[model samples]
Target: MTDVLARRVQASPDATALVGVGGAEWTYRELDEHVERVAGRLAALGIAGEHLGCLLETRPATAVLVHAAARLGCVLVPLNTRLTPTELDSHVERAELAALVCGADTADTAVELSVDVPTASVDDTEHTEITVLDSVSPAEFAPASRDADDPAVMLATSGTTGEPKLVVLTTENLRSSAVASAFRLGITPDDRWLDPLAVYHMGGLAPIVRSALYGTTVVIPGEFDARATLNALERFDCTGISLVPTMLRRLLAAGSLADSLRFVLLGGAPASEELIERCEKRGVPVHPTYGMTETASQVATARPGEAFAHTGTVGRPLLDTDLSVLGGDGKSVDIGETGELVVSGPTVFAGYYGDPDATARAFSERGFHTGDVGHRDAGGRLWVTGRRDEMISTGGELVAPGEIARVLRSHPAIDDAGVVGLPDPDWGERVGALVVGDVTDAETVRNYCRERLAGFKLPRTIAFADELPRTASGTVARRVVRERLLDNGD
Candidate 1:
């Protein structure tokens, strides 16, 4: 395929491409210029065809760099800004990042994470004061011709064992995702999508890429404040948006959705049935989508009409995608039978970066094993149960119980720890911990973990025990821990 941004500029040069909620706007032509400028700066640092880590918040600059990295043949790795220096260092090393680009807010963290790699700073505002980029001119760079199969982005997802694994999505995968999403959601020239999710997430970055391809507009609301997002919806006259369950709940609590909205593409975490019913009653068009970072963005997305009728299903697979529910026998289960979800599509990611064993294990004869347990109806719609693994879904972020257990075990007084997700009305599931240690209070354990883990990964509740329940093979019995933690009650 031709350069995504360049092709968009050719088709709609003067069309509004990127808009800052109440700040600034850039046409496709203007965005192309900015992309060229950023691409040149990256080339000045000899960053072509290398993995580039971007530690940035959701803003226009990040969107510009997304296209710029594509133009320069760089595999963009969007770093989670909430991660601690210690946590981020491991990911940086694991991804083998060649260089790092940071916004002003993240410059210090970039310095800590890029000890072995080169780092640069960018002025995210309209004023273009760049650090490493200042020494180079746009005239010095030429856009590289990229193959469709070339790796475009590398995103980190937690493995079953709690280690961070990088998933590589190619150019074709992203393009196919955008096309499939448009077929389901429908795109228009006037469609302005207000995005509040972080660029580090596929949910956030997908709109930026999809908007370019469709020659529409993506509005950055800076961050997801319930009131601010609602105001932005009206202020920008946005037609569509993407949100996780928590954000949508907060928005419903704050105020009514804007009249200009057509659809809200909900994913990232499970949306409570109550939340979906509320939206349906309120005339809010909420589409429940089931996807992971591996699929670029969407696998199955229930449209507003289907959503109102079905209530819980995540709808049928996207166009050009195939999904199956597989039992322990490694065969497709009967309809309505709960089994592991397996997905096959043009949108499926290339593989986990630099890990052949993981790549092999992630796929089978049928398709990529999703590790999520769900059943499909006769209509082919998916109803998710829970994770086949022990990953916790709190808010929209996926937290590894093993990761939290590791941090708890690091404490001086703690002997052993077991972590699990407990059901909650608000956050889909909240992180709960069972500690076998000399901990007098829960705050002490939480305070210790706060230093080592991100806020979302920290346990919300702590229960003390003599020892953790373990299997005969000496592994912690996560189901028992979940049950026991629920029995203690926060």
Candidate 2:
């Protein structure tokens, strides 16, 4: 792994390696030197092809460390910066991280975790010790090469589903994801990608892998600032950018993006057709994609409109990935029938780290048993339904709030909608919606949805607001909404 990847850097020393937040830049030559130095540090601390943990911001240094770790054959565990100190500590202990590194911003919290490992402050580390941005031959000490089967990332649960569980992914898993993404949205040498999504999440971390593999320039925003991302697009003359549906809607609604861009990858959360159409109408090349942390990044994406158009479809699977809709009996469902979307591919994660029971539960011998419910059309395009656990049962009827939200979005007056299940004595659970836009238009919007949605599926109640609750990964927090609605006695 280190030999091949490091040679690539050495072969193109003069090439611009990367550019990121806080006014940082690195050419291939400089990046090679930096990686070697950092690898030296890791080796000096006896951290080899073992687990090395990190809590850092999105910056040039973070990218350098990733490359360095790969060279050192060390398993990289990126701790969520947003997690509490206790949460961070638990992950470190779970990964058995013998050495940890943190940026100046997160060092205190890392310390609070009481990690027995040697910890270093990356941000405050003296830059003069070796070289800041200078060309040097790659270090002589090369770590053992890791095949596609070797673990590259060890991700833990976010506690959204009880306690966090570890998800270990191999190099092949990440490479396959990067490869699939590049195929979906044709990677170009001249293309510069902007990723403002959180680094701790798969949504954000995937970009680093994608760019490194492709030798493409990725312009990373320090954080997810809508305006800052907009500014960078103009400033860097960036060509391609990845965004969640929430960010794309915000950017489009902001109406400040330039039209010079080629492709804007929209994923991380399901989006209304209205949002996708708006992006297309704005002359912004929009490709709606679908992916999860378990799948690396993207599994499918709408192909440049060369493919047939369908409402709410995430498009067909890219090369080398197989997808099927399976019924409750673990058999394939008809094309139009809804079932659990099962995926088996090189990109699938190895197993849940340290949790054999969870690992067994998450993956079948055939493929990953994704709890995500979806259906595949005759043309092979995948359309995601709501999660099985999130499905609402009302009066002996099964209702998916995502279906209602999609219908509500068709209303011209409705900006955004998030549907949930609310307690109802008569119907066990009634459908409710939290919408963004004028509450006065709720009646007209309800009428609009009535045209397409069945009576049992139409929301019985709607709470209008300026925005809906969102998670770091860009998904609307349905459980959070349930809690809020319960607290409000809605």
Candidate 3:
């Protein structure tokens, strides 16, 4: 199709396009000019049609670069700002980037990187070639005409279990995803979506794309602050917002949410039933979603009013998307049978960047084989059990960590819970749990789980933590939990 932002500006030039947390606002026309100016600067640096790495925080500058990349026909590689220098280096090398862009917050990490590429800083005070939106004297420019299959952006998967892979999303993939999301969650011309997720994650990046396609507004807080987000909802008259369960929990605890909010899209990880119940009780309109990096942002989302009824279910697939639960023989399993989940549709990513073997293994004749295990009920609702790789096999019995974690969260004393397989000489691998709550006595929590879960599914070992480690997307970091258990000599 055509340039998303260019088309939006044509439709409604005076509509508010973006609002920063610090009271900075830009209309559609102004934002288009900013993107064009930034694209001109990149053109001067010979960055056209090349892979560019961006290590920036959530701000207006980051959104400008995202649109500018599309205009220049360059592949934008959104780097995670939370990654360490070593981790950043690995991604830079993997992408074979030609140039790098950094915001003021990540300038030090950009300098420390070993890659020998031209670097530009997006800070206004910094006297660099990339001085924030440096004027290039208004001139005639047009977005490069691109094929539908051309790669638009490359985002890294959350490497909770292993090394993250760079997913290559095509122009069509993004367009389809935005269109499908709008169809599922009706879009209004006056809709303003509040975004609090990091730009590196798909959850954050998709809103910018969707807003452009729908010609609407996106209000972004500088970062995720419970109080600030609550204020933003009322201040901006936000009709919709996206958040992880952790952020939602904090916001609910802060106080009553704004009545102006129409919908709260919750995902990034499996949401606990207790959390969903709390939202329902508070009159919060939450739509529990299930998606991954491979499927753009959301493949399936529960409807607004139906969320409380289906509690833990992620609802059905979005428009034009198909999902199936397959057995070991690669055939569709019966309803309510837990197996691997596979997705197929225009919204699916083209492939993993520069990894043919992985690209081949990830997809089959059926579709993209998501390594997640879940089932679909007769009513066609999907329920995610856990990751196939994360399953705990103890005493020759398989146990899903999500099943145990859900039960632990039901206890009034437990605020959050994460389960992992711990080494045990007797059982091969014993069920271990890390919990955050008021209760310090392990026996009391274990007894609580004993009533809800089966004997084999019960956690044999329990430890208390002030808070669990989380990735940038706010999902509990299982890998970190396993490492900490080893370090603690448990």
Residue pairs clashing in model 2 are 166-353
Could you tell me which residue pairs clash in candidate 1?
none
TM-score of structure candidate 3: 0.96
lDDT of 2 by residue, 296-401 (tens): 7777788647322575788888778888788888898898988888888988888888888987888775698877788887778888888777789999998877
Q: Rank the candidates by lDDT, best first.
A: 3, 1, 2
Q: List per-prediction Cα lDDT, in the order shown.
A: 0.84, 0.75, 0.86
Q: Provide the lDDT at 283 for model 3.
A: 90
User: Better model by TM-score, 2 or 3?
Assistant: 3
What TM-score would every model get versus the actual structure?
Answer: 0.80, 0.91, 0.96
Alpha-carbon shift of residue 235 in model 2 (angstroms): 2.4
Better of 1 and 2 by TM-score: 2
- The candidate scoring highest on TM-score is 3
Q: lDDT per residue, candidate 3, 383-482, as tens digits?
A: 9999898889999998989989999888888889888998889999988888899988888887888888889988887777899888755667987777
Identify the superior model by lDDT, candidate 2 or candidate 3: 3
Candidate 1 lDDT, 85-180, residue by residue in tens: 878898898888888888778876766653477777765423233355555555476677778988899988743356768999999999999999
| Model 3 Cα shift for residue 20 (angstroms) | 1.6
Q: Give the range of the ten consecutive residues with the poorest summed lDDT in model 2.
A: 127-136
